[model samples]
Target: MIMRQAWLSSQVLSRVEPNGQAASVWRFFAGALFPIQLGSRGVRRIKNIAYGPEGRKHLLDIYLPKGPATAPMPVLLHVHGGGWIVGSKHQQAQPLIQYMASQGWLVIDINYRLAPWNRMPVMIQDVIRAVAWTKANITSYNGDPDFVALTGGSAGGHLVALAALASNVDGLRPELGDADCTVDACIPVYGLYDLLDQNQAMEVGVGEIRSFMTRFVMPKSYSEDAALWEKISPINHISPSAPPMLILHGQHDSLADLESAKAFAESLSRISKNKVTFVDLPGQQHAYDCAYSPPAPEHARAVHRFLESVRKDKQR
Candidate 1:
């Protein structure tokens, strides 16, 4: 157990260092250590399946339980978060994905077009495309397409929330086929929900929000058109028909403030007819479950239980 924790720490440090030169070495060691510890957990991984035309950015990785089953397993479509600027389907959510797959679930981690290049709606479109692809083709991999759930942390949490709340919205689907992209349940961990609120809370004359918006989110600044920010925010789109949701946020999160998550949950509970469960991790920071720690496994178990409850409810 001690050795495993050491390797996990090394793995996290390798990927998080600011220095570009040392990153590769840490990544090498992290990569080498992970499989030895996890060993796919009796699951088979299918890599680099294309979901869109964005070349590498549109690709996703799938983890399927080994051997045959009497029935198709529930699917978890995971979106990664990098503040909409940078992030990959790989590396993030390793513990959650592996543990879920080990417990007889089909887990898919996806990548989408980044900002300053892809922009708003495009990132969401890529996610919709990935969902469409999964619904259409996952049966071949022994996954039950109809029982798909969405999960991600940070920016990923935001995207999944938007995808769930705005499911099948014509403006978002656009060129994508007429497939039902609705998920059975959604889990958004430490996600940013209200962009406009975030902008309003920013200190006067601070260009951080403006800089991020201009470069990654949209060409028009939030100040130029504040209403547009609300239009794109997931919190503003919630409805009674939206799927059941599980929100996980750390009390100590620096990014994606906890109060925002609480407010969002309150709104959802008041408005939505479905169940909304919020778990507040004490003393936990952003992306707390990403690393190997006591909290990581405990959160994973919470996720498993939540997913199972949703699945059972759907079965009835």
Candidate 2:
């Protein structure tokens, strides 16, 4: 009964907007469930470290494992998803980050510039900058610079996939200086692989594609130059030199179509020299791993196994 009450209180507190009503409710439950620490213990957090000159938008949070530093641990850089419009490093992937840190890995959750204001390649550039920063400075935090892995969901998934497949492309790293921007493995969860296909498949005379293009995707329409859409799509960049990837998608992801993710994984498995594993979660939604959902722990275990496999292969 007490646990149920606490859960209800948390739900209420999360939705209550600032005004008099929320304040009254918060005061009433202040002593009951005010301080909530859902993250795992024994994980040291270094918050709000700048990765680039873009101020807060370029800041990141690092999670280090507990105990003495014996050797450098492998790194997992997490990016959050909000349709390239809204999201923060602190919100999404807390459960996954805490779990990974508890198991002795240096985790980095980063915030990148959003769309409608930053556009397509700029967001990718921010991710590249974050990787460059991690490579250069993660040693001080006891992270292995050479064995970095990338993961994220939705828009974040797209960025991570792009960063992995398009590593060290001259155009993406124009101002970030010369830094080894390669990742050992990538796990892009529920990402859109082909922007051109996505746009073209939209129903004719529908304003959704036009609205998405003008508002978030890019200022230029797909009609302007179809090749530009292909250029930005990760599916078009798959190569023999690309790193191992585990593409995870929900069976019913309404936002970023499940078929697209499956097709992307199939292409990667066929063309890329690296190992490609695809997991289709039954009855799962887009951000299923974000909270204490049923599949969160199971997915975390799967991720742990994948990371271990990648690490073993890297050592060989």
Please, what are the lDDT tens digits per residue for candidate 1 over residues 1-316? 5434433433333332123322234433454455334535587889999988889998999987788867898999999988887989767887788889989999999999888776777888788888889999999988999899999998899989999988677666648657878889999999878766642442222356557677768757777766656666888788988889989877667776787788788888888988898767656678876764445644555677778887878889
Poorly placed runs, candidate 1 (over 4 Å)? 1-39, 198-207, 223-227
lDDT of 2 by residue, 225-307 (tens): 56656666898788988899988877656777777678778878888898898877655677866764434544555576688
> lDDT of all the models against the reference?
0.77, 0.77
- Whole-model lDDT for model 1 versus the true structure? 0.77
TM-score per candidate, chains pooled = 0.84, 0.84
